[model samples]
Target: EPEVTQTPSHQVTQMGQEVILRCVPISNHLYFYWYRQILGQKVEFLVSFYNNEISEKSEIFDDQFSVERPDGSNFTLKIRSTKLEDSAMYFCASRTAYANTGELFFGEGSRLTVL
Candidate 1:
């Protein structure tokens, strides 16, 4: 079974620093997304990418964030000027193109901490 995988399972960075979280979605998945869960809070959608472009994005995914598919296999999220509020578990997810209602496959998540 294919699944998403993320790197830097946990990251600690100083406020105002930059960070990049990486994810590798299942090869067959056509839709990819980045979501975050602030401790003790509900999960929030960050951005969604399809066909090499951003299909949709949430308010929280402001100018400080960016996503890329650099190649055929890797998807990445870059956060510039990290803030204290940016601390959270960031998840990378994907779903098949045909399964409009398909459940999203999520990675274990990369925990980001800002000091």
Candidate 2:
């Protein structure tokens, strides 16, 4: 079985600091997504990437947030300026094709804590 892997499992940073969360998604997956879950809320979609372009994004994904597949295997989410509300469990996920067939593989998560 394959799985997505994220780095810096837990990060603590002060407000206004820059933060970059990294993930290496399953090699064969075609679609990649970034999601965030506030402490007690359901997961919210941030952005979806395919073919080196953004396929979709949510309102929460403002100018301050950006996603890029820098190379063959790494996908990254960068928040230029952290805020208290930015603290949450950020998840990276990928699926081989579409939601109808392949299962979405999710990384354990990169927990961000903004002080």
Which of the numbered candidates is closest to the native, going by highest lDDT?
A: 1
The lDDT for every candidate, in the order shown, is: 0.97, 0.96
TM-score of 1: 0.97
Which regions in candidate 2 have their CA more than 4 angstroms from the true location? none
| Root mean square deviation (Cα) for candidate 1 | 0.8
TM-scores, all candidates, are 0.97, 0.97
Write the residue-wise lDDT of candidate 1 on 1-115 in tens digits: 8889999899999999999999999999999999999999999999999999999999999999999999999999999999999999999999999767888899999999999
Which pairs clash inside model 2? none
Local accuracy of candidate 2 as per-residue lDDT tens digits, 2-50: 8999988999999999999999999988899999999999999999999
Q: In candidate 1, list every pair of residues with a backbone clash.
A: none
